[model samples]
Target: MGRKKIELKKIECPKEKSSKYSKRKKGLLKKAEEMAVLCDSDIILLVFSPTSKPNLFYPHSRPLGRILERLSNMSEYEREERRSYTKKV
Candidate 1:
């Protein structure tokens, strides 16, 4: 039998919501790290919690400031060009 699809809604209980958020955040951070290493590219992930606390993830082997500076220096067109090139097979 096929698996049942879970309804998408905000988790009501605070404890359950926190637990789910923690688990999912950990998994997302792991994937971000893997992608940075596998692609040999600079990647930054910023997530804010309900409390407005920020969490940042990037390739630890690379300088975080350098990555941010490079990203900040990129023009909007350059950023879009890079994304387009990457999307092309």
Candidate 2:
């Protein structure tokens, strides 16, 4: 038999929700680190839980400020070129 599918809704049980969050958050950060290393690229992930707690993940070599600065310095033309190239591939 196939695995059961869960309904797309908020988990009502506090214990179940916390357990799910802990497991999934770890998985998400691990994948981000793997991708950054494998692709030789910068990656940042920011997540907020229902109670306003924040989580952040990024490549160890670069700081979040540097990434934000790099993005902020891009010109409109450069951004457009990048977007076009991504669409073509």
Candidate 3:
């Protein structure tokens, strides 16, 4: 048995939109946590709802900004080069 499929478009009803967002957000965070634990990774996940509510998850040992700062160290050109290389493979 498989789950029912829903269209990829935006949900038209406000209540349904909010409900779906809440469910998906929790699921995403849960998966990220599982990945971090199983892989022994440092993860930082952040989600902002359409209503501007912020939800975040990260390793307890480090501040979130430090992880973001590591990403910032890569120049835009360097990032683009890596992206293009991956596409070729």
Candidate 4:
């Protein structure tokens, strides 16, 4: 059987929401791992629960610190590009 579409609104019942969250979170992490393995790509996933618990996923070859550092560097590069473009305009 196929899955049905789910609405984008918040689930009203806390118990139902929690159950859905747990199932979907596992599926999402599994998909991330599969993509990394099949595509030979680095994957890092960080999710916070409704109660603010952290769940982190790093593929076998990827390090969380390295991912954060690379993301920080990219943001800096993007900011510089934006500033230069603004100055030229």
Q: List, residue by residue over 1-89, the lDDT tens digit for candidate 4.
A: 99999779988888898898999999999999999989987778889987788998988687778877876777777979978999999
Model 3 score (lDDT): 0.85
Superposed model 3: Cα runs more than 4 Å off: 61-66, 72-78, 81-89
Clashing pairs in 4: none
User: Considering summed lDDT, which 10 consecutive residues are worst modelled in model 3?
Assistant: 59-68
Model 2 lDDT tens row, 56-87? 88888888899889987999999999999999
TM-score of each: 0.76, 0.72, 0.68, 0.69
Q: Which has the greatest lDDT?
A: 1
- Decoy 3 TM-score against native: 0.68
Off by over 4 Å in 4: 72-75, 78-89
Among the numbered candidates, top TM-score falls to 1
Question: Which residue pairs in model 1 clash with each other?
Answer: none
Model 3: per-residue Cα lDDT over 1-89, one tens digit each: 99999769988898999999999988898888788778977788878987898888886766778878877898999989988999999
* Candidates 3 and 4, the one with greater TM-score: 4
Query: What is the lDDT of every predicted structure here?
Result: 0.89, 0.88, 0.85, 0.86
Error of 1 at 72 (Å): 1.9
